[model samples]
Target: MKEIRLAARPVGWPTAETFEIAETPVPEPGPGQVLIRNVYMSVDPYMRGRMNDVKSYMPPFAVGEPLDGGAIGEVVTSHAENVPVGSYVVHSLGWREYSVADAARVRVVDPAAAPTLSAYLGLLGMTGLTAYVGLLDIAQFKEGDTVFVSGAAGAVGSVVGQIARLRGAKRVIGSAGSAEKTRHLIDDLGFDAAFNYKDAPVRDQLRAAAPDGVDVYFDNVGGDHLEAAISTLNKFGRIAMCGAIAQYNDVAPPAAPRNLASAIGKEINLRGFLVGNHSHRMPDFVAEVGGWLRSGRITARETIVDGLENAPEAFLGLLRGDNTGKMVVKLG
Candidate 1:
């Protein structure tokens, strides 16, 4: 089996030199375990946090260890009766050709139902779940509310905007890093307004896009984005602080928000969340998103890179806002 290991810790942006690929004998499954031949692996912004030595909700990846994230594959062999060989599953197996893990840790996926198994790693999996729980369960979004999402062209942000619209939001505004992505949000994803953060100050852009003020902010990129959201949020506004892609690689402390006073005066509720905290709601989220997909009320996009060896570059691209939606690497 071929796998990508952490060769070195990165500074600012990760490079190909940070990862090393190696091949080893494929291991057989043990009792209660299964061997998965990985088909696809996810590359997300949050993984950047795990590369650092800092304390976080999740542990940092050790050097010379296989870097793991969410992956989808077929069960090549199974010691557990419940998950038989040939069944498709998703698990945290990293950038590998195959993985051996306990059957209980993986979820079975029906390719016939979704067609592309990679979708399970993206829209129908953790990314979608994060958006769902953050907006509804945590943020308690209400109908007719104006919604704003940073990193709006990426996986979680895209889903958050669409779901808000499907739930009858009065208006949905999004901020991306490029004009092309901004157009995609408004023209393709049904956002009421979208802007490129590079075009103007985020606070100014947000003000223009949401002239009525934002009721719910699905914050994905922190730093200036969060500061802007804080300033523009209306009274009783809710913020689901999902990620801080901007400051992930900063060696120096990021600048503190100058508009925290707004949070106090507006009674804004800003909460940082991890998807794992909302795992109990997965079944309900899957059913709802599935229904929405089948009804043509929601859509998904993915940027796929072809080889496990390219995983590092793909991930770096994601951090630079090069991907329009979910970024995944197909293992071959």
Candidate 2:
């Protein structure tokens, strides 16, 4: 078995030198455990925070240990009663070709339920759940609301816009880094408007795209985007703070949203959320989002990098905004 481990904590952007690939004997599943051969592993913005040795909602990834996240695999060998051999499952042990985990920690996945096994790592899994909970639960999205999203071409943001539309948002606007992604939001994802933030100042772009003012903001990229959203939000607007990808790799303290005082005047609700905290809503989320997927009212897109050896490149690419939606490593 081969796994990638952190060789050093990155000060800014990580490079290949920060990662090490090592081969080791594969372990057998012990009692109440299962051995999994991972087929797809996800690389996300949040993983960058894990690389730093800091206290967070999730523990930091230790140096010289396998860096793990969402992974979809087949249970090649099982010692537990419920999780049978050959069944597909999703777990949190990724950044490796294979994994050994307690059966209690693995959830069996039905290939019949999703378009593909990798969907479990994206639209049908944590990625989708993040968007769903962020918009509806955290942001308290209401019908006819005008919504805005940052990083709107990425996995979670893409879904947030679509879901907002399905729920009858009056308008949905998005901000992306490139013209291509901005077009994707408008043409493919059905966002009412989208702009390339790099083309102009975020505040100007957002204000132009959302002339009526934004009722809700789903924030995936932070910094300027947050400040812009704060400036453009309507009175009593809500913000679902899902991630801060822009500042994740900063070597020094990143600039704060200078106009945060606007929140007080607007009486805006800005709440940061971790998807894990809203697990209680998973069943409802799945029922609603799953139907949308089946009816073709929503879509899941992924940018896949082949092979376990290229996982670090995929992670680095994700941080570079090189991918449109979910970024996954296809190991099978």
Candidate 3:
């Protein structure tokens, strides 16, 4: 088996040298364990936080240790009772060709229901669940509310916009890093208006896109985006602080929000959340998102890299806003 380990902690941006690839013997599954042949691995912005030597919702990845993320694979061998060989499953296996994990930690996936197993790592998985819970439960979004989403063309942001529309939001506006992504948001993902944050100042672009002001903000790229959203939010508006992808790789301290006073004056509620914190609501979320997908009301896009060796590059691209949607590594 081949696996990638964290060789060093990165400063500004992670480089190839930060990872070390090694060849190891494929181990057998222990009692109550299963061996998964990883097929697809998810690369998310949160993983960047794990790479750092800071305390977070999850522990940091130790140097020389194999990194782990969400992965979809087939169970090639199993010592567990319920999970048998050939079962498609999702587990946190990190960067490896195969992983031996407790069967309880993996969930069997229905290949017939979802055409591609990768969807379980994106739309039907944690990314989609995060958006659903944050917008519906945390933000308390209602019908006809004008929503503004930052990092709008990426995985969670894209899904957040579609779900808002499906639930009857009057208008959904999105912010992306490039012109092509802006078009993808408006034309493909049903965002009522989209803007390239690079083209103009965030405050100016948001002002133009949401002339009447925003009722709810699903924030993905924080920093200036949060500040801009704060400035434009209407009274009693809610903000879901999902991820701060913009400042993930910064060496210096991030710029503080300049409009927190607006939050107090407008009675805005800004909440930060991790998907794991809402696992109790997973069943309800899955039921609703499944219906949305079956009805073609929500669409998902993925930027897939072909090999595990390129996972680091794919992750770096994600921080730079280079991907259109969910970024995944296909390790067939």
Candidate 4:
């Protein structure tokens, strides 16, 4: 088996040299564990933060050690009582072709529940939950409210807008990095309006997209986008501070979002959330979002990069906004 390890801590943007692929013997599952043949692995914006040796909500990836994230795999061998061989499971042990995971830490996934095993790593899994919790729970979204989403064509943002639209938002607007993504948000994902953030200042584009003012802002890209959302948000508006992808690679502190003083005057609620903190909402999340998936009211798109060896490229691409939806690596 081969696994990717963190070769070094990066200062700004990481290069291909940051990851090392090494071959090793596949480990046998110990007591209460399972040996999984990993199939699909997740690549996300948050991983960039883990590359740096910093204290955060999650532990930083140790240099010279295997890097891990979300992965779905087949339980080829099991030493646990409840989990049987041939069952599928999702775990946080990616960047490898196989994984030895504790049965307690692995969530069994029904292969028939979704269109693909990869969906467990995205829409039906953590990615979807992030979007669901961010909008409905953190932002406290409501019917008839106008919503704006940053990084709207990406996995979490795309779902945020769709869920908002489904929940009867009056108008749903999106901001993406490209024209194609803007089209995907509007035409395919049903975002009422979307704009290419690169075309103009985000504040201007957001103002233009939601001229009447935004009621809820789902922020994926922070920095300038945050400032823009703050400036244009209506009084008593809400913000789900989901991610700050824009400044993840920066060495200097972000300069924008200087309008936070306005939040006090407007009595706006801006909440930062980590999906781990909201596990209690999984039952409601799965029932509601799962029904939407089955009824075709929502879509889970993925940009897959084949082979575990290419996982580094996939992660870098995700940070570069090269994917329209969830980015995953397929391992053979």
**Best candidate (score: lDDT):** 4
Q: How well is each residue in 240-330 modelled by candidate 3, as lDDT tens digits? A: 9899988888999886687698788899999988888898888998899988888888889999998888888888888888898889999
Q: Poorest 10 consecutive residues of model 3 by lDDT?
A: 255-264
Q: Quote each prediction's TM-score.
A: 0.98, 0.99, 0.98, 0.99
Q: Model 2: per-residue lDDT, tens digit, 1-332?
A: 89999999999999998899999889888999999999999998999999999999899999998899999999999999999899899999998988999999988889998998989999999999999999999999999999999998899999999999999999999988898998888889998999998898999989999889999999999899999999999999999999999999998877879999889889999999999989898899999999999999999788989999999999998998999988999995
Off by over 4 Å in 3: none
lDDT of 4 by residue, 1-332 (tens): 99999999989999999999999999988999999999999999999999998899899999999999999999999999889999999999999888999999999989998999999988889999999999999999999999999988898998898999999999999999899999999889999999998998988888888889999999999999999999999999999999999999999999888999999998999999999999888889999999999999999678999999999999999999999889999999
Whole-model lDDT for model 3 versus the true structure?
A: 0.91
Clashing pairs in 1: none
Clashes of each: 0, 0, 1, 0
lDDT of 1 by residue, 80-179 (tens): 9999999999999868999999999999988987848888988899999999999997788999999999999999999999999999999999999999
